[model samples]
Target: MTVIENIVGRVTVLRGGRYSVEVDVITSSGFGRFAAPVDENPDLYIAEAHRAVSEVDEIIGPELIGFDATEQELIDSYLWEIDGTEDFSHIGANTALAVSVATAKAAASEKNLPLYTYLGGTFTTELPVPILEFASDSEFDYYVMVRDLMEITDVVDAVNGVLSNLKEATVEGYSEATEKASSELGLDVALGLAQKAPMDMEKLLTLVEDNNVAYLKPMGDEELFLELIAGTHGVFIDGEYLFRQKDILDRRYYNALSIKPINLGTLTDLYNLINDAKSERIVPILAEARFESSDEALAHMAVGFRCPAVVLRKDSIAKLNELIRIAEDLGERGRVITFEG
Candidate 1:
């Protein structure tokens, strides 16, 4: 009975004056709205937001008006048919993807299930490790945040660790904290970093390898991706990488991939990406979408069940407690919260 009644799409200017589509899917029970993540590449942008909205208004809306939003495959199939491209070209991947996510949300709300509970299901209790991120230096009880930790390390580590002990501890200290916390919990925790931007990938990898750090979310283009892959670093493939060269996904050259739903365009796509990551022995680290609202963050935690870890950026600081609550509600624990002020 909870079918889609109608879908309305709009164009909004996002941060930095980029445009994206925001789509609202109204179902018999409730409505869900999603704003597309900003596209970084202009040359291959998914159709302008206005044009995407126009297609949604004139064509996609009519076909989906009475469709069952919960029938994800059916609805997404229609969306793909409308676009007729793997990346959503004809009808705008951003718009189509937003509708896809909105539809999933609406359906979940209709069932009165928290989005994470729905995506992760009722009986699944275990959750991924939370990789706490801090934009500044801060201190908190490791016992309060650290819990059971797990890791998969190869033979490469010659040294170890994280921040200059400012936003985070020195990379060596970070690893020690995780090690200490793991000892307390009797769990095996590995340190991860989102700090490859300013560092030399080769040198940084050596640093992390020597120090015993586990992974690096060094986001970059094809060349960087290939470099990370060749170095056998646990690469964190993200939205920008996905948008630019998803073909890289065809080859499982890395050991980990961190993705956000917004970059993926739909709940289904996000789900599939996790599956892909898993199949390739790549640990999926669900990262926050670009400036996503709180609900989207919840959705990430919901699917966090499917990943080994989830990375929360600085924007998630205020909502971290709420996110932890949701994870606990699902019987999932192990939260490492790092933050800055």
Candidate 2:
């Protein structure tokens, strides 16, 4: 048995000088580390990171000392019980997730198994398709949905060509630009939008219709959410607004949902949500928080969960590079997932 010996947390400074908590879980036979980045205001991120580390060293670490690292469900339950909060507001969700994931990694190390193999079993080989978001020099953002990354010899060059066309095209001409780039680069590309604020429904619908946007992350009231689903034709509506609302799946409000580990609080919770989404025939896309660490555990989780797609930004190269390595490791068994949405 791999018994938990100690848990240590340190403040880690990420790119752009952002702060995150790096957790080290030490067990009787192995060790694991994970960095938890919180989605907080830039001004308060440093303080939040420090507080999480302090909570781990003084509170969570001491309580979990004698627990078995392999008993993931029990450890996650204890995390909720100790926090005594419905939303993990007391201890913070990022802290709980860090501890939960690190425990899994520790147990995997004890057995000399890869993290994905430990969590997903021996036959998990399919890699999720990368949903790469590129922002042009003109500040226009679009997504390149690669059908098969292994097929592309130079992904950077292909994406550069896509961005160049996007820079010259107007918002109304985005669909044409994407289509042109797709034909020239021989890649399946699509337009994507993330709603940061409320917009007129007519305007939103017009943009979606005109640009042929295939992916949307909308944030608004239930009416707006339902309207987007109803108005668009074959658009992949990501359920960012519907996080933790599994009941909404029954209504089929969104075809896909973004799974962020920090929002779920623990690995058990994240796993349950992914299973719930799949059981409902909804696609689960592993997504990072607005702010993130360089940790590549998320890439492993995407493969482990068998998620079809991963929504990642340009700066998330660490996760992308990790996916490439996982693909190479899987060899002939590795294939990009077909995006259903």
- What's the TM-score of each model vs. the native? 0.69, 0.91
Q: Estimate, for each residue in 31-78, the C-alpha lDDT of model 2 and write its tens digit.
A: 999988666545547777899899999999999999999999999999
- Candidate 1, backbone clash total: 13
Candidate 1 segments exceeding 4 Å error: 12-18, 39-47, 132-191, 194-202, 218-252, 297-305, 318-321, 331-341
lDDT for each residue of candidate 1 in 217-264, tens digit (9 for 90 to 100): 555555665666566443343333443355555443455666766666
The TM-score measured for candidate 2 stands at: 0.91
lDDT by candidate, in order shown: 0.58, 0.79
The 10 consecutive residues of candidate 1 with the worst lDDT sum are 152-161
| Poorest 10 consecutive residues by lDDT, candidate 2 | 148-157
Q: Evaluated with lDDT, which candidate comes out highest?
A: 2
Angstrom error at residue 301, model 1: 5.6
Model 1, position 338: C-alpha lDDT score: 19
Q: What is the lDDT of residue 23 in candidate 2?
A: 89
